[model samples]
Target: MTTSSAPPVAPAPETASTKDPATRPRRRGRTGKPPSALLSRAGVTALLALATLYTLLPLTWLLLSSTKSREDLFGTNGFAPGDEMHLAENLRHLFTADDGIYLRWVLNTVAYAGVGSLLASVFSVAAGYAFDKLTFPGKERLFSLVLLGVMVPGTAMAIPLYLLAAEAGLVNTFWSVFVPGLVFPFGVYLARVFSAAYVPDEVLEAARMDGASEFRAFCRIALPMLAPGFVTIFLFQFTQIWNSFFLPLVMLSDQDLYPVNLGLYVWYSSALSQGHPEDYLLAVVGSLVSVAPLIAVFLMLQRFWKSGMTAGAIK
Candidate 1:
């Protein structure tokens, strides 16, 4: 061992930079991207920040404006708070002005958006799961029809829907709005994507082999996996229904049946056409009220929605 240890060690060749640390290039981070790529990433971040500001600016104005009276709203800068906060006054005015019909509109909106979205999600999930996992005659043809429905703008179909609703005597009722939304073609398409991506055919087959009926297997097994998809479809339809102005405008004449959007529109029009500016404030406050539910729903469901959106990204 002593003899082996005595073997000569070769002298290590030294780089010039190694000897003088100050002369050496600083080590970069392990980010494999080049400087241009880094700059591009920074640029993209800045662009997104600007876009976010652009989008939120009007909403910020709306929020600030809602707190002011009609007088202060017009007098003050859009982004600035008014002389006095009258949020409570505005809300009270909103509820009481139309004999509490605004509250009815809110309730009607909840019903249409909530129930219609739920039904749409269910129908979408069922149809999508069937289209992906089942083999039946006219499958592609039916899916093509659904795709065609998606391509046809809902607004273009509004007249057709109104005509059909008239034929069925469902016009001017919640059912008129509710029924049309339940067959959401976009929801079906999205559901198909999710079903294909998330639900495994092998698992369904296994469940079938284990003495489960198709519906039973779907409910007990596949449905749980489709949770994210359901949430996504629900949120989409909910937003659509909540923001739907034209359809409800066409369908319902009754103030009692009006959703928040249509009712708010009526107020906004009255404010403009009739020169009662306070009604404008009522419309603004009602907007806040209408938006609150959607915000709440989004915040509540975002976890599932985001996970659903990203789940298939890698796999």
Candidate 2:
């Protein structure tokens, strides 16, 4: 009896496999509520399709209409091709009308948009660089004032600009339009944003430490880095100046000085008032031609523009 006591048995420790099924915690799998109708992939694709259609509709109409005769332009459906293609005839008429004033308008547009955009980009970049990297008194206040200018519509500023031009004896002259195009407040804002995003302080510091002057550093180092931004600013300013009608309308009386947009308007107005169907055709063709440069510029610089837009988006 003294030797026969059984040793106490130890219970086995519980493990996952040994646990009761009902007592084990449920794991989370990939399960959730469905996305909303509007946010669904199908919905997003549909919206993009609609937007593309909306944007291309007018351009499609313009292309078809340009191929039509004056009679077909009014008679046929906007999207339909004309019975007879008259595009060449229309272009010839457009170029020859009013002693080839359309060509003058095209050149004027080129000069105003091209040169003005370039100059504006340069000035804006310089000012923006100064605002971002260089410190001075009243910098924030000055920038705030510039931001205010961006809020003001260009149309609202036209009258004041006209008054200033008149005071300077520059109204109805090329300089009136050209000078105003140079001072793009929005471009300044864009340049500052681009400078902050693209141009690094350390790079400038390195250049400066090497005894490079501020202006030299800007030209040699900062400017090349800001190339994409420069092109972005140029394209924006170009489009604005190219399509600018109100400013030129207020500032210019001479037909020779008209940009393509304003010139087209004048032709359309005269066509309506004078009962000239040919002028209507000319306007249409001129409009088609007017779009070419914009398309070309965008196509050429789109790579730079894309890079500029995505700069600093991630970091």
Give the winner by lDDT.
2
lDDT of each: 0.86, 0.88
Each prediction's TM-score versus the true structure? 0.85, 0.86
Cα lDDT tens digits for candidate 2, 81-175: 86444887788888898899999999999999999999999999999989989999999999999999999999999999999988999999989
TM-score of 1: 0.85
Tens-place lDDT per residue, model 1, 138-212, is 999999999999899889988999999999999998899988888899989998998888887777888899999
Clashing residue pairs found in predicted model 2: none
Residue pairs with colliding backbones in model 1 are none
Predicted structure 2: lDDT: 0.88
